[model samples]
Target: EKTVVLITGCSSGIGLSLAVRLASDPAKTYKVYATMRNLAKKERLLDCVKGLHKDTLDILQMDVTDQRSVLDARQRVGEKRVDILVCNAGVGLMGPLEAQSLDTMRQILEVNLLGTISTIQAFLPGMKTQGHGRILVTGSLGGLQGLPFNEVYCASKFAVEGVCESLAILLQHFNIHVSLIECGPVNTNFLDNLQAAEPGSSGEQVDARTQSLYEMYLQHCGTVFQNAAQDTDDIVKIYLEAIQSASPAFRYYTNSALLPITSPKTAASDGLQYIKTMSKIIFSTNNKVEQK
Candidate 1:
């Protein structure tokens, strides 16, 4: 029997790739629900998976932010014990905290953190009844380490991290497993669709002080975090393992960095290491070459 796996945010990137690969695996069958907010925007995705076996993939519409939409999807998935649930739907926001309107910040939290909670709650009851299920959430490197402009997005992932940690412990007695996949810099529309606060939505879009600081911070991030720099195959492998393995892990990290830095201890150490490394670099450079 094919494992019934439901995944969100399957319109593109890692979610889309995993759906295609998992459905194509002949050894392990999967009734994969590849969900997206707008199925109309996913014609290419639909075309790409057309060759897979008819039973392998089912495209479903889901908006993690909308309660009605989620409940509707839940109805469609009714009584079918989900073998694995991948909570991958989320948005990114980048700017100074002050530049973001209160409403915008609230929206980010609603979609990323609250939406995840809703999905878990909707599916978890059936999983518990079945006596086994795997829940994997998509977190970010930003969750592990705070980035300059992604304060709200990072906070959302941090919230996810804590929730997943607690859930992993909470669901142990029920034989259900909850895990988090902390990923870094995958090539995705995630960056392009990131929300920005409307300048005039609030009393002001952004005052001069906030706007100047935002631009500076954005510039620094651009210089540090190169676009599409990481190999994503490793991350997908981790996801497949989470879904298939009987003795599944509680957490995994995927990125260009050789060491998977996802744990709270690792995150803190990385921050301290980064500061020490930068200080050394500055001092060494100053000693080697005088400013021109």
Candidate 2:
């Protein structure tokens, strides 16, 4: 028997990698429902799974932000029994506070936070009744420590952290394991997907000092992406451990090199030290030096 895995946002990046990894498992352990928002954009995943057992992988359309879309995908699954659910569908937003719009902020909460909530609500009852299931979410280091220009993105992940934490405790009695994969700078389309500062919003609403801060932050992130980003395959390995563990962990951090940034408790209890330290790290000049 194989686990029925339904993963969201599988068009590319970690979602696509994990779906392929599991579906291609030589042991044939997973039957993956690799879902994306648009069926038209699923060519990459189709190309990857070409030789694999067709019965093991199914590509479906699921826009997490839409209730009808999610439910429709659920209906397509037919059995209503999902052994493993990976809530990986989310978007990113960046830029100074003044340059970000209320709409963009709301959209982040919608897709990242509310989408997770809706997916869990729909599937949890079945897991509760079955007394066995694994719920994994793609969390982030931003969930633990706030980033300068990613206020909205971090806020969404922070909320997800709390949601996953609360559910982990609540679901334990039913033997339903909840795990959060806290990622750091993975090689993904995440940066490109970030809602660019609204047209002219950066120039019009953002002040010179804040705009300077935003540009500096982007440069810092670019350096990190170039040097330290984890590959999608690296992340998929951790995902396998989470899925396969009998005693699964609640939170799994993928990038140990980023511990200093993600471990908030390492900072002074007062939080002032964390603020100062993070600001310095975010605005550091070493990235330019490394580039040169």
Candidate 3:
């Protein structure tokens, strides 16, 4: 029997690739319900899966940020059974912390944190009752270690990291597995979405030193992604492994180059040393960025 899968944020990026990859499986092992916030944006997904077997994939409309939409989407799934639930729908917010409005931060939390929870809640009962299920969330390497100028975005992913980890322990008894796909920079529209959030006047009001720090951070960020970012396919492969494993890992890091960002926390007895070390690394990088 094919595993029935429901994946959110499938209009593009890893979600789109994963949906197409599974739906096009030569072995016919996966039946995919690929969902997004708008059906109008589904052209890319349809085009990507064009030559693949059509019967394996169906496009659905669901906004992960909206609980009603989540519940309604679950209802639309055939038999209301979800063998694998991919909580991949999320938005990004990046800018100076002072410039990020409270409302925008809340929106990030709603989609990244609450959205994952709501989606999981909608399908948890079925998974538990069936005696087994897989829950995969697209977390971030940034979630493990905070990055400068990503205060709100990092906070949202950090919360999700906690949620998935806690759920892993709580749901394992039911034979349901929860995994966090801790990703580094991947080529995705997430950056575009992050820039689309409204700006605050702090951009105008901030002093020169603050502005310099932000500019240096952006420059360093551009170089990091350009040099080390993984393609969407790379991440899809990792997710596939998590899906197929009989006993899956709780956390899977997609980018190893960024692993150093997370190591200091555990390397120190109190984590204060970790904080100091990370700060120094960040400032040193920015200093070089400033020289250029």
Clash numbers, per candidate:
1, 0, 0
Per TM-score, the best of the predicted structures is 2
lDDT tens readout by residue for model 1, 64-102: 988888878877864367888999988989866666788
lDDT of 1 at 264: 40
By summed lDDT, the worst window of 10 consecutive residues in model 3 runs over: 195-204
Q: Which ten residues in a row have the lowest lDDT in candidate 2?
A: 259-268
The TM-score measured for candidate 2 stands at 0.94
Q: Across residues 77-195, which tens digit of lDDT does each residue of candidate 3 receive?
A: 87568999999988887777777666777888888888888999899999999998999999997788888788888888999988888888899899999998988899998788774
- Model 2 residue 109 CA deviation in Å: 0.9
Better of 1 and 3 by lDDT: 3
Candidate 1, residue 190: Cα displacement in angstroms equals 1.1
Q: Can you tell me which runs of candidate 1 are displaced by over 4 Å?
A: 198-201, 204-213, 256-292
Error of 2 at 264 (Å): 5.3
Off by more than 4 A, model 2? 199-204, 260-267, 286-292
Between the candidate structures 1 and 3, which one is better when assessed by TM-score? 3
**How many backbone clashes are present in model 2?**
0
lDDT score, candidate 3, position 144: 86
